[model samples]
Target: MSGIEIIRLPSRFDYSFHRQFGDLYTPLIEGGECDDIILDFSQVEYLDSSALGMMVLLQKKSSVNNIKVKIKGARGATDEILKMANMQKIFEFI
Candidate 1:
């Protein structure tokens, strides 16, 4: 099933992640095409609740579809946010 699709967001993750999440993530989840999803946060500097909410939504949707959502390259404030949300347990971080 190719596991997961890699979607790269812009460098300014704090500003653009929400938009990108909606534009890129919604269709992928709704399509029910893959069992795993990976979001590359290498370029992301920060993440807020909105981003966290999106992640939760994605994970929940994926769970229902029997998919796994993994996150990679998260650093700085972005990483902190994920930790604060306790999303590391839900997502495989790399």
Candidate 2:
């Protein structure tokens, strides 16, 4: 386990997020350089199903690497979406 790596989400988490996050998260996790990945959602106001898919993908990748994934600052609808998706079991939220 290494140090934590944080990624701040955009205002809208969509397909672009998928592409961008993939590029960023892959190396960070697969490189075995981070023990935890914290996704900051403070600036995000909306996240579509694609975003959910991205998160699940993140979870899978992180799990494969034996890394922890946390979600932070998710509020209102964004928080609700995560809860509805049962993400609490998949990620640690703070």
Candidate 3:
């Protein structure tokens, strides 16, 4: 496995986020080239269930390939949302 691959999230993490990032995400997770996939939420102010679902899907995909899915830069409401979803256990946060 290689180094981490970072995917930065947009301000609003809604359903459309997957559509925009899926192309990059699918191949990266499926390629098995990285040891970790870091989702940067520095700019994300809001996120919905769809976003959470997308993250879970990403987590599953990465796990299948023996890759770690990481969450980074989540703050304020975004952090709270992730905590509320119990995502801290599911993903490595940094």
Candidate 4:
């Protein structure tokens, strides 16, 4: 079974994104036994440090659980930010 599935965040990925993550994604991640995850960032317009931190945390958790995390469809500013932060190397982009 799939571990966690996160769709692309619309527009900005700031506090609202974090709140949504906590409200939605976190529970799914915590409750599941599987570790594989896919974070779709196709429609994201912007992302800040908090979003990056959250990604890192997710990656760490996945690593600890022996899960494979995949990030797909990141483009524009969001892609740039991830690249700048060297996250592109850490995550699988498709």
Please tell me which predicted candidate would have the highest TM-score against the true structure: 3
Better of 2 and 4 by TM-score: 2
Q: Candidate 4 on 16-67: residue-level lDDT in tens?
A: 6777776655555676665667778887888889888888877886676567
Clashing residue pairs in candidate 4 are none
Q: How well does each candidate superpose onto the true structure, as a TM-score? A: 0.81, 0.94, 0.95, 0.80
**Candidate 3 Cα misplacement greater than 4 A, ranges:** none
The RMSD of every model to the true structure, in order and in angstroms, is 2.0, 1.0, 0.9, 2.1
Record all residue pairs in model 2 with backbone atoms less than 3 Å apart, i.e. clashing: none
Deviation in Å, model 4, residue 29 alpha carbon:
2.7
Go through the candidates in order and give each one's C-alpha lDDT: 0.78, 0.90, 0.90, 0.75
lDDT of 3 at 24: 65
By summed lDDT, the worst window of 10 consecutive residues in model 4 runs over 1-10
- Of 2 and 3, which scores higher on TM-score? 3
Give the better candidate number (3 or 4) by TM-score. 3
What lDDT tens digits, residue by residue, belong to model 2 across residues 1-94? 6799999999999988777989879889878779999999999999998998898989897898899889999999999988998999989998
lDDT of candidate 3 over 13-90, digit per residue (tens): 998877877876888877768899899999999999999999998888788889998999999999999999999989
lDDT of 4: 0.75
